[model samples]
Target: VRLAMGARDLENNTVEVARRDTLTKETLSLDNIENTVADLLDDIQKNIFRKALNYRQEHTITVDTYEEFKEKLEEGGFILAHWDGTPETEERIKAETKATIRCIPLAGDTTPGVCMVTGKPSVQRVLFARAY
Candidate 1:
């Protein structure tokens, strides 16, 4: 704080309180960074779970399967559909059909289903939304 205050010429401001934040520079490789990112993604998954719970509480509807979900796509919100994690379907869906995916799930047995667009078998449940 003292060094930053001096550098910023904040000595003239008496009412401006300052505090210092210290951080350590650990020796880390790209692998370490990748692991850290993975850890962060784990936390984000938890956060998303909470959000999903809230979403369910707020707007719960029943669609038994991917086929059923696809049949009801004319009306829109966030639609969860199985995908191959490709931009082609998502992008094409957005371009031709005007749907945007909000997100993909973190982990699940989300059963393989056909892509909402190409009718190809999907690997994961990719979210879908209608964009403005």
Candidate 2:
């Protein structure tokens, strides 16, 4: 409190006050378990995040053609491939390979190229996967 208020002497120590909002019902007794529960929740979130990161890193794949995409899909991973930027082409690839466009990254290779499935023009690659 003294440091926060820029006081240098103990006798002239400045006071500080703070407030925290709590969501527990008025009748529910916390009994000091709130900290324990918060710690457990933090640990659980960290574990889940690490598991997802590892899974994505282990399963990610990149392919340049429809044939390669099919082969990679059989192996089961996140596929990065050029898309023609049309729903029809996206649906056709999904119908043929059971892989769907999971996400289109905001940042990726911007060079124009032929689509992996339809040979149509595309501006960037998209992420494909067999979502669970």
Candidate 3:
């Protein structure tokens, strides 16, 4: 059976450790391994997905003005804001705020507007976040 690899568990897993907790003689039963893997998969599909989706929803923000964008950017999380779609404006925003446009959603707000930084016309909003 295939195991589901959840985001939370994968994010928490660390390969480097101070010491080995398990002894050489220690072993796991096939049933235990299968059950653990199965449980993890279920958690990934149900719990992790929901948690991540919620996190994104909670963190996402929309701004029509540069002032609003700057204020929200300081607090962290993703910002869905209109960009003038110019390299100069994008670079200036990133240089000032340490945030970069992460992606343009396939189904984002299609409403035309002005860029937050340059006040130039923008076709759509783009996702922006601080570099990790």
**Model 2: per-residue lDDT, tens digit, 21-47?**
222222212344456456645765676
| Estimated TM-score for each candidate | 0.45, 0.68, 0.68
lDDT of 3 at 7: 57
* Model 2 weakest lDDT span, ten residues long: 17-26
Regions more than 4 Å wrong, model 2: 1-31, 107-112
Candidate 3 residue lDDT tens string, 2-60: 33344553565422211122212222234456565566556556765787889999999
- Every model: Cα RMSD to truth: 11.1, 12.3, 9.9
The sequence of per-residue lDDT tens digits that candidate 1 reaches over residues 43-100 is: 6567778888897545423343545665556655566666656777667666766667
Top model by lDDT, which number?
3
> What shift in Å separates residue 65 of candidate 3 from its native position after superposition?
0.9
Q: List the candidate numbers ranked by TM-score, top first.
A: 2, 3, 1
**Candidate 1: global Cα-lDDT?**
0.55
Candidate 2 lDDT for residue 78: 96
